[model samples]
Target: MSKEKLFKVAFMNQGKVYELHAREVNQSGLFGFIEIGDFVFDESSGIVIDPSEERLRSEFEGVLSTFVPVHSIIRIDEVKKRGNNKISDLPEGANVTQFPSPIYTPGKGKND
Candidate 1:
């Protein structure tokens, strides 16, 4: 937990998806629960946790022994990379032109 080091931690237990960026994850009050792994997915925020809680808990169970808190989960499912778009996905037809070209006629008078 050095100041020069950045923690890649993830929390998953309950039903809340949250992410935090800090030099030391342990020092950032993100402790208490053990890291599951080096890979956790935050569906709500659409962020893939670099360090998963499942993996961390198994690997470092003996070194820094702890349990995942049942109340600190940030997400239930891993958010898709595409994300939820608000615009419609319908097909485009010839009648649907995003922009119309300006008409120009030869010798067209301004008054005309």
Candidate 2:
């Protein structure tokens, strides 16, 4: 995928901007409108927050109170990046070989 690829999803709860990939967004039991910048996971705690009404109230001021299923997402985009090579173009066959690097050898007869 291209690095520039991004999605402009609407945050059903809060109006914030977060550029992300469709794959990165985890959609499971979600139900209403998916907010753009809202996160399903807690950043600091690194915990998955349940998208429920009660959970939303305790965490983000009723934000994400409505479950927006992943299916609700509409806008999706492609990212652009360099060196995007196909798997078939990669070198294969018996010609492949590994080379030793001089960086591994250190002074005083020591190997780094």
TM-score of 2: 0.21
lDDT of 1 at 30: 46
Q: Candidate 1: TM-score?
A: 0.21
C-alpha lDDT values of all predictions: 0.35, 0.33
Estimate TM-scores for all models.
0.21, 0.21
Candidate 1 worst ten-residue window by lDDT: 81-90
Provide the lDDT at 8 for model 2. 29
Per-residue lDDT tens digits for candidate 1, residues 1-112, read: 6334333333432232234222322322343343433332233543654344434334444553234453443323333232221112224452432232333445768777
Candidate 2 wrong stretches, greater than 4 Å = 1-13, 21-23, 33-74, 82-112
Q: Report how far off residue 102 is in candidate 1 (Å).
A: 71
Highest lDDT: give the candidate number. Answer: 1
**After superposition on all CA atoms, what RMSD does each candidate show versus the true structure?**
20.3, 19.5
